[model samples]
Target: MAYFLSSHITSTLWKLKPLALKTTCVGSVLAVNQRKYSSKDDAGSEYLHRSIVPTMHYQKSLPRLPVPKLEDTIRRYLAAQRPLLDDENYSNTVKLAHDFQNGIGKQLHEELVAQDKMNKHTSYISAPWFDMYLSARESVVLNFNPFMSFNPDPKPEYNDQLIRATNIVCSAVRFMKTLRAGLLEPEVFHLNPAKSNTDSFKKFIRWVPSSVSWFGAYMVNAYPLDMSQYFRLFNSTRIPKPKTDELCTHQKGNHLLVMKRGNMYVFDVVDRDGNLVKPTEILSHLKYILADPTPAPVCPVGVLTSENRDVWAGLREKLLEAGNREAVQIVDSALFCLCLDEEEMRDHIHISHNMLHGDGCNRWYDKSFSLILSKDGQAAINFEHSWGDGVAVLRFQNEVFKDTTERPLVGPTTPPAPIDSASAVQRLEFKLSPDLEHGIAKAKENFQAAVSKLTIHAMEFKRGGKEQLKKKKLSPDAIAQLAFQMGFLRQYGKTVATYESCSTAAFKHGRTETIRPATTYTQRCAQAFVQQLGQHSVEQLQGMLDACSKYHGQLTKEAAMGQGFDRHLFAMRYLSNSKGMEMPNLYQDPAYTAINHNILSTSTLTSPAVSLGGFAPVVPDGFGVGYGVHDDWIGCNVSSYPTRNVHEFLQCVQKSLEDIFTVIDGKPIKSS
Candidate 1:
């Protein structure tokens, strides 16, 4: 006989399965650190006074992240998988699900419930989730990680590389200051404000779970890779350097490492008082490095990080052993890395090439974030996914862009107090052994081989985006998601299971939830648009549109409530392993594999603040669509391999949106 547990335990497990757990954010590194002081006053002015500040002060007050009901989670899971399976397979899955729920499922759920109740850690899932993000996968860095590019800031007239870099430094410092001071407000789910609270708010700054001892069980702590390890961000190579236990301590130092022409320079970003030095002071050091003539061939050493994680880790051990302790310390201890790239970025393709894997040299890919500035002043950020999701970084980008645009800085007119220019910049030296040389050669071969296979296409859909969608009384996100689904169906001539990330930040420590966009409604909508064409009536088009919108909204709500299928199923599977249970037949069923294999992997980040966002496809034949939906325009970064035509797909997506707009407006569809 099984012991019946309280509902709270099941609910806790539900909450624990939130999709946002997989999302990451830049923690305290934006740079300022302060102690919490005042609480909110009745008028809300105290919070309002600090404008656009990112802080963790509200974390303690936020409600704990909640879990959804077990039954609800299972129901949503079946529904999500329903569209992808045939009747026989799906019916078998239904029986398996029922058997588990009635028999062993109850036991497993109870164990999880007990675990959640007794687990005093920051979050039960944070550590395991992070471990999978970091050490689990063989592919590390950019392939599995996602990145975004900032179009050149127009306000700052930084034709000179050093001056533009300085402006960026200052803006970054200001953003960090806000984050450190805990001034930035946390993001809330506007659709359900009631669910927004402190624990969720705390996730913004909570990199790794801080107090595992509270759980009385040894739960791995998921530290925010960005905040807790800010100083470590520079010498940071995802590659494990030798004497790392000792060298990691150097990351606490307050300096920024500069990688330029073929040399590495160390410079102080923080002054004696611990405040970031002024932009002019930083420019002085950059100027000194810029003056170096006849620089050596830039070390191809950074390429080791771009290799397969296991391969890089093995190579890093050798590289660290070969280099002097001091050199390793200098590389590791610097606060963050700044690359002074001399490449002229003429277009997005150039930007993608240089930023993703810059000539295999001028970059240390393991750093939490690498700020790469082209000679032409165009900038792109190559970030490590282990740090956090694109949301936090998006917030970081928005803040910096706003700072630069609002107050454009002309070149500094006055020189700073006389200081030895030589003292400001120190070059890091690495004495390579034959072993190190061989490792470097192998890493380069692997890096180039991987780079050759990717096909990336970046384009802007100027026809219509948020504004036109709103005019049609449609949700921009839902419609945009449909456009991609329609586009994929049109291109491949068949519908496949899709993954769309929807934020559950409203819940405590919420990350993301999967909204399967390839649903019955989506299929109907696509079929109508593709087949009916010029013959469709306005009423029929509206009906299809309404069905698609309704389904999208329903999934979004379920995801926000932690009732989406993916994470819950994942959590159930994870918990089974933890409890030493046998393999569940539900997971092994073909129906399970069908839905889990996402062929249309897409995400929408509709912000005017960010120009481009992208990620690799979850599957080889799939396309990764990271789109930004602005009022009148849509910026899309479509990523895939040689098997798919990303360029033609983008055109199809744009045309699909146009077709939908015309059909919805009661106009006849014009043949493309």
Candidate 2:
């Protein structure tokens, strides 16, 4: 359970980075020129002269992530505890924090700083962050991987499974080609694109040395994020070991892995000379795999990936010993995995369940990522969390969505190329012993039990959103978070610990820092809205809203700047454990335990391409909240285990938002 919590805590932490790039005519122009140049030049030389500044030009000069001051971290920690702890408990916790700050914590902090200084190329959190994910021994299914679904194509005709899958595959290959060639645009947050994200700025920055290029971009209000994780976007899988896992990448492998009805197939999507196969040829192979009449395997090997990590590692060794080494190698080395589901999605809730964690037979959960498509053409990317965060995945999704929708390489009427797909695609078969087959059946049973215990519910608030909140001179995110607080209070009548992720991507190889949203201000504001709505004056309630908004905004800024207390304390505790030191009194306190078990684990991302995203709860009693504050509406997709009522919780959330909007509109709060 702790492993599951840790996976989501770190997984949601990095989704706050804004990686969506603007679609412009200039980009379209560049794409056209790139396609023309590819046709004329050698494959390697095609993108060499396309971009004035290469994709990774600013990586060397990005600033290093900073460690927060010890006193500041302690101060923030105590403040976060104020809302959740009683007076006596808070006092005891404060004393423990004080003693720890002066005693062993100082030594651990010094050691951590020394370690950070020695590793200058990477951020302080990089190695430990990787270790945290790789060392977890739980199944990756609901514990680690998450899904972000793409919106349906505008042209209804293109939504046919075959056409949509083909376009996605082709566009994905094009994205990979552009990224590897250094022609894809760098991931940047432009405060003023007119001045910073311009061709003139690129022409000037191209002359600067790579080591100092980041400064030039920074001077113009453009922030370039670390791209180190992008390398793992392709040809990578998480290999289960006895107590840990390893991220393996086989860059030389050019084949794509496709799964249907529990069977696996692979075919080369890249030609021998290192160029993408024609879209028609790729479509023919995918169509052939879809048309294959193989029955679903009675013992699906893919379900083994959903077992406990150690258990899976043992089963994997047995599989290799049973003369299945070649088949396993093919799976591990494939560029990426694609699942073709037979059922059409009924709606958003159904889509969430299917994409988040499927029946466990058609998905290879250990792959770096898998692109799943339903028979009716709904699509989503369910990615393993160990390799990277949403930055790389979202960028890839944004580009593919744009390319496939705006300039599809294949359409509904396009005919599959006349090629012998039977020879091109290879069906992967594993030699399973009786023991292995029994293990697989057990895995399937366990997976079914796990997924069956989960529930998902979604809601949309149409009364107001980012536009409305901004018009009221309030932070939309703060307001969205405030609704969660009020919703929890309305449902359970108390404020618990909450976590919202904020990215620190401006720094080199940066991960994420936690934004503790269950502050004293929000607690006060939630009480006014939920319990004392009719008693308080409209102005007074509005004032509390302003206070909540202000405090939350400040917390967000601090977390984004990597000054939050969560990661600092987390790293120190991890260090203490690693060094075999005694656990600090502060860490042993019940308050510490309570804060780490976040009941409302929330993350927000808004993109044109992503319809919605979701993850299962980190704890059995918690709610995993994924939301987006759009222009005129705010949407939430939440998940929970049987310990909580997800449906009723969403109802409370809707009412909370309505009450908030009523107050924001300078009207009296209405009682439910």
Candidate 3:
């Protein structure tokens, strides 16, 4: 989920409010002791911290997300608009914004604040955010769900499909057990892990009550994030409805759902006592499914999930009416879906395509998530967006990757246990009427048409990266964002609206806030390098880079703190629509529509466990850019529809990065 609000009128019917704030008063003695700890972690200790305290210990005392004042939101909103609009259009947008803040927006803001007081459990954006996703009429395949690919194992032999799948399944069950037992580590950002991540600190914090544990952790500058979405990680599915969808989770399911060649199979991974079955048993069952000689179904029912929400809802009703209720229940109540693809990935482009949407027949797009592995052992996760954000998913991935790689339960030489494989694994069979079969056929056609229009490409910049930029005292993220601006300018000779998603998970039940990266500073700096190269001195250009970095840093902090303007403005508009009030002139302005369109949708997620991540363009003529800035290189995996030139765009981005590196290295700017 990029935090872009859908412009569909039906999606604006929900009311939203911020979670109530919680204040803790710690004794002076503790405060003095906390001051002795450093906020910087020792080298390589950042990922060493483990959860000694219970997982939900910080839930009660975590502070609520704040509501920015109407004036501040207006100011920030206009500042973001200024870079994307011309002088005449900006003047018009300014008047509309002024009118809104002083008029109906004031009342809307008041009502939003009052509602925040009434609803104390979730952040202001939660309800509307959910509404934005569930209410979307498009299929979740490309328009909504995203994929993150796991890096190939260090040991080449471990990449064998059966070996990797067995290990992943076992590690996944262990993760579930650890989480259910409350022994899993809480997600935290340790500014200085050397102090807060020590055994003594963990022992002390373990004794603190759950209600006040957040305060204790905060004293040492350790920030624990919201883990409310973790519970939905297993045994969950998204059920389609006429106008919206609901997230369904069953806590008692013991069987695992496996799909291959459009056929469904189920086998028990958890015993009756809720303990994970032996890894040997899991391996045997998986081997049975893989060795089955059944061919692909003539009418693969799974593709129906890739249909439009309303269409899928209607087809689902037909399935139930056709006596497929038990089969549907088994799918919905299974622990999780594990997809075993028959084809091997050919390259990075093939990996992106295969992992993202895949041959629609072999995928269950409505599952809370799916762990997919190809025949060649390349693995990735494709997940439903409405149930949760990447925070929960990434944490789960990190743990699973660590467990499977570091302490794998199954090895290359491990043999499947001698057992009755046929009786152990049950193939799920659904009765289908002719109408349902026709629906499946149409769904396959639609899925093919939709995914066929997409073009994906990948690029890597080895000239410079995070380390090089850090040495120059520039934000690596800022430099990356600036590269996008310059790249767009160099390709299309214009600057457009861009979006970067920032997680607001520091607060209770928080979602995301939009980091509008196309700012006036970035625009000016991009123009200097892309258009006026050789006209400016290297020192002056370096100063511009510093300015862009500093401003971007400020934007990132503001968004993380829930002080960004986009969500606030979105909430107010949602409130207005729910109350049946006429749309505010500010929203009616074309400038508002253009900004929300977000031509360049970008998000960054860097993890040791992840090789790449990607999503499709949100609009027909846009780019879905997933990028990472590693120590020595920056990589981008981008997708586009036919309206855009993805290949040329990446070339421009690469050139822009090279030019920026040259300027940083005190070399003359290359003439365009």
TM-scores of all candidate predictions against the true structure = 0.82, 0.94, 0.93
Runs in model 3 deviating more than 4 A are 1-51
- Per-residue CA lDDT of candidate 3, range 1-672, in tens? 332211000001011222111110000011111222122432121122234667788887777888999999999999999999999999999999999999999999999999998888888889998898898889999898888889999999999999999999888888787788776667665556777867688779878987778778877767676888889989999999999888899989998999999999999999887777888888999989999999999998899999999999999999999998999999999888999999999999999999999999998999988999999999998888887776777767777887789878899889889899799899999899999999999999999999999999999999988899999998888899899999999999988989887666778887777778899999999999988877889999999999999998778767767888999999999999999999989999999999999899887766667788888888888998888777899999889999999999999999999989999999986665
Please give the lDDT score at residue 1 for candidate 2: 17
On lDDT, who's better, 1 or 2? 2
Q: Give residue 440's error in model 2 in angstroms.
A: 0.6
Candidate 1: tens digits of C-alpha lDDT, residues 1-672: 000000000011232232222222221212111112225422121112143223443333333344556677677777776766678877988888777777766676677667667754334444445454565444554456565667666655554566677766666655555455555544322112222233343343344332321121111211121122223333344445232211233435677777886567887777777576765667777778877774655346666667766666676677667756676566666666789888788888777767766666677766666777888887767776554445455556665665556553437464643667687778777877887778778877777777677778887877777777778767676787788878887887777888876544434454445778788888878877876576667678877887787777667656645557676667677888767878888777777787777777776553334455566676777777766667787777777878789989998888888887777677767877
As a TM-score, model 3 comes out at 0.93
Q: Which wins on TM-score, candidate 1 or candidate 2?
A: 2
lDDT per residue, candidate 2, 551-589, as tens digits?
A: 887787677678889888988988999989889888999
The lDDT, on a scale of 0 to 1, for candidate 2 is 0.82
Kindly give the stretch of ten consecutive residues in candidate 3 with the minimal lDDT sum.
Answer: 22-31
